[model samples]
Target chain A: MSDDWSAEVEELRLRRRDAMALGGAEAVAKHHERGRLTIRERVTRLVDTDSFKEVGTLTGQGRYDGATLKGVTPAPYVMGLASIDGRPVAVGGEDFTIRGGSSWSGDRKKGGQGGFIEDLAASYRIPLVNLIDGSGGSVTSINKRGHSIFPGVHGFERSVELLGKVPVVSAVLGTAAGGPAGRAILSHWSVMVDGTSHVFAAGPPVVERSLGQKIGKEDLGGTQIAVDLAGTIDNRVDSEEACFAELRRFLSYMPSNVWEAPPEVACTDPVDRCDEELLSTVPKDRRKPYNMRKLIGHIVDNGSVFEIQPTYGKALITCLARMNGKVVGIVANNPMVYGGAMDVKAARKQIHFVEMCDCFHIPLIFLVDVPGFMVGRDAEAAATLRDGMRAVYVGLQATVPTYTVVIRKCYGMAGMGTTEKNGLEFKIAWPSAEWGSLPIEGGVAAAFRRELANAPDAKAREREIEAELRAMASPFRTAEAFGVEEIVDPRETRPYLCRFIDAAQARIRTSLGPKAKYGVRP
Target chain B: MAAIQVKADVAGSVWQITTKVGQKIEAGETIMIIESMKMEIPVIAEQDGTIDKFMVDEKTAISEGQVLAVLTR
Candidate 1:
C-alpha cells in the first residue's frame, strides 16, 4: 500500500473553498445589494494589485460526521500583510457578512483590538490600515460561552502602541459600533465613506433604549456628525472608491515608520515658480477677505495639496503638501471665517495636525493670518481659551523646524504659537503683515479708554491713536529692528519657502524617530 | 427655476446689500457684505442665478447659518 495523502489534501482544498465562499452566496449578495463591497473586495481594491497575502484563512468552526469532516464556517475577521504604493503594510477588516461581523473568539484574534495584524505592524514597524465594518460584541455571546467576558479582554494596548511607532490608518466602511468603533478612533488618521458608513459608540436601537430618544442611524452618526461637526473622522468622500484613493494619497506623504523620513517625490514644479497673483492674494483693503485655498494652491507643488479636516475647521486650513518635492504640513488661517480667529474647532484641529507632523518628523509651514482667539460669550462658553492654549502648548512642545510667514494679521497668543520660539525662531513676512499683543484698532480703544472718554471727539481721538500705532506696526519696521527675520516680496514666497524647507531636511533627518512629549496641556 | 437659499457663515450684521432683487448674478458674485469682528466678509453666490429676494436688509443683525437671500437658477 502506497500511503497516499491525496484524500487529506482534497479535504484541505474543500475547506479553503468554504472559507472563500464567505457566509455563503446569499449573504454576500445581500451585502452587495446595499452598494457596499464585501471584505474581500475592499482588501483587494485598496492594496496594490496581486499584493494581498491573507492570514488566518483556515480558522473557523469545523463540522464533522464521525471521523469524516463536513465543512468549515470562516471567522468574521480577515487580515494579512500587503503593500501600498510599493511599501509593505499590514491591512485587515471585519467580515460583515458573517453574523454581522460580531466579535469572533478564535484561539487568537486576526484583527481588532490587540489582533495579530496589529502585532505584525508593530513588529515590522510598517503602517497598519484597518477597514472597519463590524458591530463588535453581542449579548448572544454570553449564551454561547456560558459567561460574559470582561471589558478589557481585548484591550487597545496594541492599537495605542502602534500609533507612536507606525502610521495607523482606519476607514469606516460600514456601520461601526462598540469595540470596532472605538478601534477606529485609535488610528493616527481615519476616514469614512459618506452616505454608506456610520460610526458611533452605539447604534440607534441602543441609544433609543438607554436615552428614550429615537433616531435613525444616519442622523445619529453620519459624515455630517462624525466628520464635519465633531471632527471625529479626519476626511469624508463621495464613494468607497474615492475613499481608497484618498487613503493611498495620504500614506504617500508619510514614512513607512517614524524611524524613517517621509518619502519625497521628484519635483516637476519649479522651486522658483513665482506666481504674480501671490502679490495681490491678500487684499489691500484690511477688512476684505480673499481665497486662502487658492493662495495655498499657488504656493505648494502643483496638485500636491491634500487638505485635512477641510470641512470641520473652516477658520483654519490644515493640509499636507509638498514644497520642493519635500513633504510639509501647512497650517494657514482662513480670513473668510470670523476673520480667521482661533475658535474651539480650529484650535483642536491645529493641535492634532501639529502633533501628527511632529511625530513623523515632517517640517511645518505656518501661513499666519489669524486675528486671535475667538471673542464673545459664546466663545468663552465653548472653552475656546483652554483649547486655544492647548494648541499653543503643543506648538511650543513641537521640536520640528517651523517656518512662519505672516501673510496678513497675526495677533496675540495665537500669533506667538506660529513661530518656532524654542528652536530657530525663523520668521519671514510680507509687506502687509501686522502683529502685536492685540490689533491696533482694538488696543487703542482699551489703552486710551479714559483719554478718549474725556476728549470732546472720542471717535477722532481713537482714530488718531490707531493711525499712529498702525504706522509703527508695518512689517518693514519689524524687519528693520530684526524682530522678524526678513520681509520679502509677496511674489517671492514660493522660492523663499522652498529654499528654507530644503535646507531644513538635514535637521529633520537627524531628528528622526519617536517624539517624546512632556508637560500637561491646559 | 430652482430656488437656492444662501445662508450666513458667521454671526454678524449686514453691512451692505450689494445685489438687488431680480438681478442676474454670476457664481462667485458678491450678494452682500457682512460686517463681523470688524471685518467685511462677502456673501458670494455659489451658483449662477438671479436674485429672487433678500431675507435680511442692510444693517440687520443675523446669526450664523441664517438664510440671507434666495436665488432662482
Candidate 2:
C-alpha cells in the first residue's frame, strides 16, 4: 500500500510522452526539412500564448500486452479551443507525420475531429480556423477495417452550418487532396503557401493511374493554378507565417459571429482627407485606361484596403477596407482589364463577393465604370448574360446599405447591377460620368447604319451623329432631369463615403439580426 | 531559347497588329489590340522576347484564353 498511486502516475506520464512524439523523430525531421511545421507548432503560432485548451489530446487506438497497457498513440488530427487576437476561436489541423495523416483503421473517431471543431465553433458562436494537410480519406484503412462505410451525412453539412453562423477560414499547409481540398474551398477566407502547398481532387499519381496523364504535383495543383487560374482560394502567401497573418487580418474586419455587427476601430486617418489626384485619375478620354486601385487607395482609410481574388476577375476589383474606422466592402471596375467591361468571371466574382458582405453585415461601396457586358460570340458561349443576370439578382436582394459612385461610362445592363434597383443610400456620380443604353459609338452604328450608308459622305455623317449623341450622354443631363441623385466633385469621394459609412453604422446598430433565411453556397 | 505563348484574356476582334513578326520586344509591351464591347484592349507580352508569329490576323474574332501569339526568349 506504500505509495500505491506513484506507479500509476508514472505510467500516465510515459503514455503522454509517446502520444506527443507524433510518428517519432525521423518523421518530424523530414517534415521540418521540407520547410513545414508540425501541427502543434502551427497551432501555437496561430493562437495567443498559452491559450490553447485541447479537447481530444489523448484519443487514439489503445494497445495492450496481456492486460498490462502498452500505450495509446494519439490520432493524427488535433483540435482544440483557442484564442486568436484575444477572441475565442476553434482551431484544428492534420498531423501529416502520422501515416500521412490518414484515418485510423476501424476507428469510429475517423472523420470526427472536423465535425467536432465545427460543432464547437457553432455552439460557442466563434470563428473556426482549419489548417489542413493530409492524404484525405485513408484507402489502406479498408484493408484493416474489412470494409468502408459511407455515412448519409458528412462533415460538409457541419461546415455549411458553421458558414452561416460564424466566419470560417482554411489554410492548406501541404498536399490537401479530396475532402481536405473541398474544405479549403468551403471557407469564407482561405490561403495557401506559394511553393509548399498543393490542392486538388486527386494527386498526380492517382491522376496518372486513372487517366494515364504524367503530371507533377506542382503542375497539377500549384498556387498559379489554384489562385490565378481557378480562383478557388483567396490569397497565396510565401510562408506559413504569412498565411496565419492573413487569417488574422481577415477576421479583424468581421464580427465574431453573424449576430453581431462588424468590429470598429479608432481610425487615425481623417474622414475629410481628400486626395486632389482623384480629380484626374479617371481619364477624360473614354478609350484610355486609368488605374482604379490608386483611386481606391485614396478613398479608403490609409493602408486599409485588403483585396480578394485579385487575379481571378481582372476586370472587376472586390476588396475589404475601412472607412472612418468601420469595415466596408468595395467593388470597382478595373479599366486596365478588358476596358472595365463585365465578363462572365467578373460577374460571378461580384455576385459571390456581394453575398459575402451582405451575410457578414458589411456595407458596400461600388465605384462604377462599366462599358457594359462583354459582347460577341465568346460572351454568348460563356453565358455572360446569364451570370450577369445573377449578379443583378444578388445585388437587388442585398439588404445592406449601398453607396454607388459613378466615375465614368456606365452603360447597359452591366451598369444597372452596380446599385439596388429600388434605391440606394447614396447614388452619387462624378462629373466624368456618362450613362445610356449603350455607348454612342456602337449605338449609332446599329440604329442609324442605313442612314449613314445612304448618305453621300457616309464617314462624315457617322462622325456627326456620334458627336451629337455623345454630347447628350453627359451625366449633368441625368442630374438636371432628377435621374441621378447628385453630381459631386471627384476629390470629395472620401467625405461622401465616410458619410455613408456613418449612416450604415447607425442603421446596423438598430437591426442586428440573422443575415438571411439560407446559408452561403460554396 | 524558351518559347512563351501569349493568350488573349478576353474575346474580341483583332483591331490591329501592334508588333511585327521577329520584332524584339520587352516585357509589358503591347503586342496587339483587340476590340470587344466597342473598346480596344491591348494584349501585352508577359516576358521580354522576340515575336515569333501572330496566330490570328487583324479583324479576326478571338475567344477568351485563345493563344494570340508566340514569343521566343
Q: How close is candidate 1 to the true structure, as a TM-score?
A: 0.97
Candidate 2 lDDT over A342-460, as tens digits, reads 88889988988987888788988899999898776667888999988888778877888888899888889888877856345457899999888888787887899899889999889
Choose the strongest candidate by lDDT: 1
Worst 10-residue lDDT window for candidate 2 chain A reads A105-114
Model 1, C-alpha of A407: deviation from truth (Å)? 0.5
TM-score of every prediction relative to native? 0.97, 0.90
On the 0 to 100 scale, the lDDT of residue B31 in model 2 is 96
Q: How much is B60 displaced in model 1, in angstroms?
A: 3.0
How much is A197 displaced in model 2, in angstroms? 1.2
RMSD for all candidates, in order, please: 1.6, 3.3
The numbered model that scores best in TM-score is 1
lDDT of each: 0.92, 0.85
Query: Per-prediction DockQ, in order?
Result: 0.78, 0.41
